[model samples]
Target: MADPTPAEVQSYIEAGLPCQSLSVEGDGRHFFATIVSAEFEGLTRIKRHQRVYAALGERMREQIHALSMKTLTPAEHGATQ
Candidate 1:
Protein backbone atom coordinates (compact mmCIF):
# COMPACT_ATOMS: atom_id res chain seq x y z
CA MET A 1 0.00 0.00 0.00
CA ALA A 2 1.20 3.50 -0.75
CA ASP A 3 1.91 5.82 2.12
CA PRO A 4 -0.90 8.20 2.81
CA THR A 5 -0.27 11.87 2.25
CA PRO A 6 -0.57 14.32 5.12
CA ALA A 7 -3.83 15.58 3.67
CA GLU A 8 -5.28 12.07 3.41
CA VAL A 9 -4.28 11.33 6.95
CA GLN A 10 -5.73 14.63 8.07
CA SER A 11 -8.94 13.88 6.24
CA TYR A 12 -9.15 10.45 7.79
CA ILE A 13 -8.76 11.88 11.25
CA GLU A 14 -11.31 14.55 10.55
CA ALA A 15 -13.78 12.03 9.24
CA GLY A 16 -13.37 9.73 12.21
CA LEU A 17 -12.96 12.24 15.01
CA PRO A 18 -14.49 15.53 15.85
CA CYS A 19 -11.78 18.17 15.90
CA GLN A 20 -11.99 21.84 16.59
CA SER A 21 -8.69 22.26 14.86
CA LEU A 22 -6.39 19.70 13.28
CA SER A 23 -3.18 19.96 11.34
CA VAL A 24 -0.89 17.24 10.08
CA GLU A 25 2.56 17.19 8.50
CA GLY A 26 4.48 14.23 7.23
CA ASP A 27 7.25 12.95 5.04
CA GLY A 28 5.10 10.19 3.55
CA ARG A 29 6.24 7.93 6.37
CA HIS A 30 6.35 9.63 9.74
CA PHE A 31 3.63 12.06 10.67
CA PHE A 32 3.12 14.76 13.23
CA ALA A 33 -0.28 16.14 14.09
CA THR A 34 -1.63 18.88 16.30
CA ILE A 35 -5.21 18.06 17.19
CA VAL A 36 -7.68 20.07 19.22
CA SER A 37 -10.98 18.66 20.24
CA ALA A 38 -13.53 18.93 22.99
CA GLU A 39 -13.29 15.16 23.37
CA PHE A 40 -9.78 15.48 24.75
CA GLU A 41 -11.03 17.36 27.78
CA GLY A 42 -10.25 15.57 31.04
CA LEU A 43 -8.33 12.81 29.31
CA THR A 44 -4.80 11.86 30.24
CA ARG A 45 -2.00 12.36 27.75
CA ILE A 46 -1.98 8.67 26.96
CA LYS A 47 -5.73 8.59 26.59
CA ARG A 48 -5.68 11.58 24.31
CA HIS A 49 -3.11 9.84 22.14
CA GLN A 50 -5.22 6.71 22.27
CA ARG A 51 -8.15 8.64 20.96
CA VAL A 52 -6.07 9.77 18.02
CA TYR A 53 -4.89 6.27 17.42
CA ALA A 54 -8.48 5.10 17.46
CA ALA A 55 -9.27 7.79 14.97
CA LEU A 56 -6.51 6.51 12.74
CA GLY A 57 -7.86 2.98 13.23
CA GLU A 58 -6.56 0.46 10.67
CA ARG A 59 -4.31 2.99 9.04
CA MET A 60 -2.15 3.01 12.12
CA ARG A 61 -1.33 -0.61 11.56
CA GLU A 62 -1.33 -0.89 7.79
CA GLN A 63 -0.25 2.43 6.35
CA ILE A 64 1.11 5.05 8.74
CA HIS A 65 4.59 4.17 9.91
CA ALA A 66 4.61 6.54 12.86
CA LEU A 67 2.42 9.32 14.20
CA SER A 68 3.46 11.78 16.84
CA MET A 69 0.75 14.08 17.99
CA LYS A 70 -0.03 16.98 20.25
CA THR A 71 -3.52 16.45 21.56
CA LEU A 72 -5.37 19.29 23.21
CA THR A 73 -8.83 20.47 24.11
CA PRO A 74 -10.28 23.59 22.59
CA ALA A 75 -9.65 25.43 25.85
CA GLU A 76 -6.03 24.38 25.89
CA HIS A 77 -5.70 25.31 22.26
CA GLY A 78 -7.14 28.74 23.02
CA ALA A 79 -4.64 29.20 25.84
CA THR A 80 -1.84 28.90 23.31
CA GLN A 81 -3.30 31.80 21.35
Candidate 2:
Protein backbone atom coordinates (compact mmCIF):
# COMPACT_ATOMS: atom_id res chain seq x y z
CA MET A 1 0.00 0.00 0.00
CA ALA A 2 1.07 3.56 -0.60
CA ASP A 3 1.83 5.91 2.23
CA PRO A 4 -0.63 8.65 3.11
CA THR A 5 0.00 11.90 1.31
CA PRO A 6 0.55 15.20 3.08
CA ALA A 7 -2.85 16.40 1.98
CA GLU A 8 -4.37 13.32 3.57
CA VAL A 9 -2.61 14.05 6.83
CA GLN A 10 -3.63 17.67 6.62
CA SER A 11 -7.26 16.70 6.07
CA TYR A 12 -7.16 14.42 9.07
CA ILE A 13 -5.74 17.11 11.27
CA GLU A 14 -8.13 19.71 9.94
CA ALA A 15 -11.05 17.44 10.69
CA GLY A 16 -9.81 17.28 14.25
CA LEU A 17 -8.99 20.97 14.65
CA PRO A 18 -12.03 22.31 12.74
CA CYS A 19 -12.59 26.04 12.19
CA GLN A 20 -9.02 26.34 10.93
CA SER A 21 -7.00 26.79 7.78
CA LEU A 22 -4.17 24.48 6.94
CA SER A 23 -1.30 24.32 4.49
CA VAL A 24 0.56 21.08 4.05
CA GLU A 25 3.42 19.76 1.96
CA GLY A 26 5.23 16.45 1.75
CA ASP A 27 7.55 14.36 -0.33
CA GLY A 28 5.37 11.34 0.41
CA ARG A 29 7.67 10.82 3.40
CA HIS A 30 8.45 13.96 5.29
CA PHE A 31 5.78 16.56 5.83
CA PHE A 32 5.38 20.17 6.87
CA ALA A 33 2.08 21.47 8.15
CA THR A 34 1.05 24.99 8.96
CA ILE A 35 -2.17 25.03 10.92
CA VAL A 36 -4.10 28.03 12.11
CA SER A 37 -6.75 27.34 14.71
CA ALA A 38 -8.84 29.20 17.25
CA GLU A 39 -8.11 26.34 19.62
CA PHE A 40 -4.47 27.38 19.68
CA GLU A 41 -5.18 30.60 21.51
CA GLY A 42 -3.28 31.07 24.77
CA LEU A 43 -1.40 27.84 24.19
CA THR A 44 2.35 27.77 23.92
CA ARG A 45 3.85 26.75 20.60
CA ILE A 46 4.74 23.32 21.92
CA LYS A 47 1.26 22.75 23.29
CA ARG A 48 -0.38 23.97 20.10
CA HIS A 49 1.69 21.60 18.04
CA GLN A 50 1.08 18.80 20.51
CA ARG A 51 -2.61 19.17 19.82
CA VAL A 52 -1.99 18.76 16.12
CA TYR A 53 0.20 15.72 16.68
CA ALA A 54 -2.40 14.21 18.91
CA ALA A 55 -4.84 14.49 16.04
CA LEU A 56 -2.50 12.33 14.01
CA GLY A 57 -2.36 9.71 16.76
CA GLU A 58 -0.02 6.78 16.05
CA ARG A 59 0.39 7.66 12.39
CA MET A 60 2.82 10.35 13.48
CA ARG A 61 5.20 7.70 14.78
CA GLU A 62 4.39 4.83 12.44
CA GLN A 63 3.67 6.06 8.92
CA ILE A 64 4.78 9.66 9.05
CA HIS A 65 8.51 10.14 8.67
CA ALA A 66 8.64 13.75 9.78
CA LEU A 67 6.22 16.53 10.53
CA SER A 68 7.26 20.14 10.86
CA MET A 69 4.44 22.34 12.05
CA LYS A 70 3.62 25.98 12.49
CA THR A 71 0.55 26.55 14.64
CA LEU A 72 -1.14 29.89 15.13
CA THR A 73 -4.22 31.20 16.82
CA PRO A 74 -6.84 32.99 14.71
CA ALA A 75 -5.76 36.36 16.04
CA GLU A 76 -2.13 35.65 15.41
CA HIS A 77 -2.95 34.66 11.83
CA GLY A 78 -5.14 37.65 11.29
CA ALA A 79 -2.37 39.99 12.37
CA THR A 80 0.01 38.50 9.84
CA GLN A 81 -2.46 38.35 6.98
For lDDT, the strongest prediction is: 1
CA lDDT of every candidate: 0.94, 0.85
Superposition TM-score, candidate 2 onto the true structure: 0.91
lDDT of 2 by residue, 1-81 (tens): 478898888887977787468999999879998888889888999998889888889888788888998888888889899
lDDT of 1 by residue, 13-81 (tens): 999899999999999899999999999989999999999899889999999999999999999999999
Most accurate candidate by TM-score: 1
Candidate 2 regions off by >4 Å? none
Q: Report the Cα lDDT for residue 20, model 2.
A: 68
lDDT of 1: 0.94
Candidate 2 residue 78 Cα shift, in angstroms, is 0.9
lDDT of 1 at 6: 99
- Candidate 1, after superposition: displacement of residue 20 in Å? 0.5
Question: How far does residue 75 in candidate 1 sit from its true spot (Å)?
Answer: 0.6
